[model samples]
Target: MPTSSRPAAFATAALTAGLALWTSGAPSVVYPVYGREWSLPPALTTVVFGTYPVTLLVVLGLFGGISDRIGRRAAIVLGLALMAVGTLAFALAPSIGVLLVGRALTGAGVGFALSPATAALAEYARPGRGHLAGAVATASTAAGLTVALLLGGLFLDLLPDPLHLSYWPLLGAVLVVLVLALRLPSGARSSGSAVRLLRVDPSMRGVVAQGALGVAAAYGTGGVVLALGADVAVGLLGTDSPIVIGLVLALSAVTIGVTALLARRVRAGAAAPAGALVMVAGLAALVTASAAGSLPVFLVSIVLTGVGYSLLFSAGVGIAAELAPAQHRASTVSAVYFAGYAVQAVAAIGLGQLATAHGLLPAIVAGAVVLSVLALVAGAAPFVRARRAVRTATGGNPA
Candidate 1:
């Protein structure tokens, strides 16, 4: 492919990926509204949220690798169409049942689009600058969420039907992207069953596994924060302002975009482990703040966790993309997301249940403990390998 044309394709794919996340972000700021209007519980709020990831997980399992066989263009277009329809559903939703349907549709769209769009960005990236694809993908994801939170908050503040009005422009955006996606070049079709593509090469197994775990750890924390953070804020800070909550959530995503852009030069091998450790510390602080009802501490934790998530997501996606052969690249990336989102689905609902049953403090403590342990182990693995390699090269002691 010529360098001249790749940027357009890359931009289209990035936008597609961004839009997929945009759909996810739409509901994040509005869940409280649902609870207030319908008189629902926190667990139900999380359930509505969980619908997206649950469907996303199913789509990834069944079709994550399908793009390799079908062609990226087809897969991307289908995903965008589903998202557009899903947003329309949101506009018309009058009940929680209807909202769940919309969420499922949105999740299915995202699931289909996520891996292929990511892989497409890599394919369209300029030669020798492939790592930028991962950074761009991370930034794009953050950008989508940022727009949704800020705009949703604004609309909610000023409008009578904030949910319906906010989705109108989002639906328009999805439609416009669908048209733009039509211009993207068709992907090279690989000859193999989609199931076969799902298999990581023997050489790439360890790296991919590590990348998956890093991504999962990062994504799991995000899941908890997104699902429960607003409620926690309301409880601890005693504020009912949706805009403030939106700003807080938006801050995390802003940090992610900035951190990812700055860390473009860092190798995945180093980024993953360092990110993992930082994430653990951040989660600990997050738990502490929630337990103590300290708004300041919670703010700090949000920033740190966003930075850590940026590092982990960018590094994990980059590592997976760089290591996989072109034929299996989409599948490999999908597999990594599959693992992360699986954790996300569980984390969202589990935390919600814990918060409802045992109390928010216990839930936060429990989630932090689990995520910290996972991050520590995942982060340390790379350094351990590096040390052993150093020892092997030195034939025992380096001194």
Candidate 2:
């Protein structure tokens, strides 16, 4: 009803947007929805899941910072429309072609909304509580991923009308969010110098390095495992149940979801190193899983890596926000995201290709190696910066 309540509204919008995008994959929990009903192939399933990131990366890259120039409201409203269209299309799909189209549309919608939604959170932030925006971004994203899979599975197993139940309810919820979206003040207005957005000025090589190393570590480990683990789980381990899918692929991020709950307690510098360590541990577990082809070890690794990915993702947002100038905060975030997605894209393609050749486990080892290097860099960056700062402050060198 009031402008001051916009942040609360945006938080809801972001959460909804996330939920919508995740359904594109979460319905895999209801593999019956597509697998048997449409006779969808395994390759097609990979396409369905992989297509979201492709469209998402492209849309976010081009339009990611449009809100910074055009205003957050328009970007968000457009994104919501896209998300609604895409989700509904998939829900009502008469064929796999339409399903793919729907998935593409979902990606486009979430991509449009993704950046704008974050920007909206910025505008809607509560007084004297700016970090609320970051928390909203991180938590909503994690919420979307977790809730989408869990609820989608529940509806699939328990409801007679799984498709309608899984999607229509979400569509209705987004309708409520659309109504809520109307209340947000246009982000184009000048908020004045008193409240400035501290942005990560990425022209600085240091900021780019910070973003690249930090995000690569998290995404390389978590994104890779999440994206590819399913094939390994199903193709190699020979499983068809939703519960198994959730445990292997989705549950990996569940640990990250748990870590997100601990965001407030973690220190500024600690998240990166901690994330690095946990991810490394996760990758190591993955190594065992890869060698032994043990689903149990693989499942445990997913949980551990997820915790680290969540922490690093959220922490990266904060750090990226800090490195920027006031005018470019959103773009700084965009840059960080671009790099993150870029890393994921490369890792996916490279590993996917390798998986195509050497087999899933070897491909997984490649991803682990990439992330392990990234983790090393992440563990190194803070110390380098700290030492440099100390050297400058001391007017020479360290003892």
Candidate 3:
């Protein structure tokens, strides 16, 4: 690869990473429309939402390290092709069955592309700014979500075919990216079993665990928001206008990009704990906003959630990139993503079902509680270990 092309490659890789989330979130604003048109329950709507991560989990487990063996460009191009197909399926879908299939395909595409794209960022990053890859990655994904919400809302409100029109643009974007990805220089390739490549070394297991937990918290928050944020907004605002709801929900995505940029210089170790605390506050505010039907509070919560998500996700990615062996970087990042998507899958379906059975408020509270605990544990793990090391060094004396 020529040094001159690295910047282009880096930009393309970022777009590829962004497109993965864009594909995943493309259907979010339209979920309510689908439910009304199809007479679907909240549980089934969430099933549609959760389907993506479930399929993504399977693909990641199976071939998360495929890029390491093949090449980043090849894997990304392949993923984009699948995503285009998936988008087409959504554009033409007549029934929920086809939609589910499309969602699965999109999930598989993201699973294939996202980790490789993240890894590519680190590789293509400028010499001194390599650590910024994680922040950039977080911002890219947030930008994707922001675009999906804003455009989906706009199309739904103004376009003739609300359900189908939005996806066509997405499909076109995927195709364009696919072509650009093809021109990306093929990086080094190595031979290894996908399973073996994904395996974390014993020495790095603790780091991987902490990184995974932080990512889980960030992604789980996003899952809950994407799954239920629209309905929550409807409850708070007492309106069903798609455009308004989209704007409200998009606050989180917008804040994510801002926070990532502002916090890019923050160290991962400090960012993790700060993010956890801020996330806990956001979750509390969310529950309060829902309970009181306070739109202002809801807006505050959304901003806080986005900021927290940016911090935690960037920190997690930074930790993984800093510690991962060069040969297995993609696989290591995939492992972190694998954990995040797992929690995201569980949160989406579980909370959706909870909302259907009890109410949205209870579901929100439950999710908030669980995610807050996890965030705290992830944030505190490094400190706990350091304290234990100090104790051992001092013959079991308290630090």
Task: Pick the TM-score winner.
Answer: 3
Give the TM-scores of the predictions, in the order they appear.
0.91, 0.83, 0.93
- Those runs of model 1 whose alpha carbons end farther than 4 Å from true positions after fitting are 1-4, 38-47, 192-198, 384-399
Which one wins on lDDT? 3
Write out the backbone clash pairs for model 3.
none
Q: Is candidate 1 or candidate 2 better by TM-score?
A: 1
RMSD to the hidden true structure, all candidates: 3.0, 4.5, 2.5
Arranged by lDDT with the best first, the candidates are 3, 1, 2
- Please provide, for model 3 over 93-183, each residue's C-alpha lDDT reduced to its tens digit, 9 standing for 90 to 100: 9999999989999999998999889988888888877788889899999899889999998998899888888899899999998888988
Model 1 TM: 0.91
Write model 1 residue lDDT over 89-206, tens digit each, in one string.
9999988888888999999999888898999888888888887777888999999989998888888898999868889989999999888888778887877665432566676676
> In candidate 1, what residue range of length 10 has the lowest lDDT sum?
192-201
List model 2 lDDT by residue over 1-399, tens digit each.
665265466565566546644644555566456776667776777787678778877776666666666566666677777777877886687777887797788788776666566555555556544444445566667666766666766677678877556778767656667666666666663333322232444364565466557776776765677567767677646865655566456576566666766674464367778778888888889878878878788777878888778767666665655545445556666666767777876887678778888887788887888788788787677667678779978886677
Instruction: Write down the lDDT of every candidate, Cα atoms only.
Output: 0.84, 0.67, 0.86
| Global local distance difference test of model 3 | 0.86
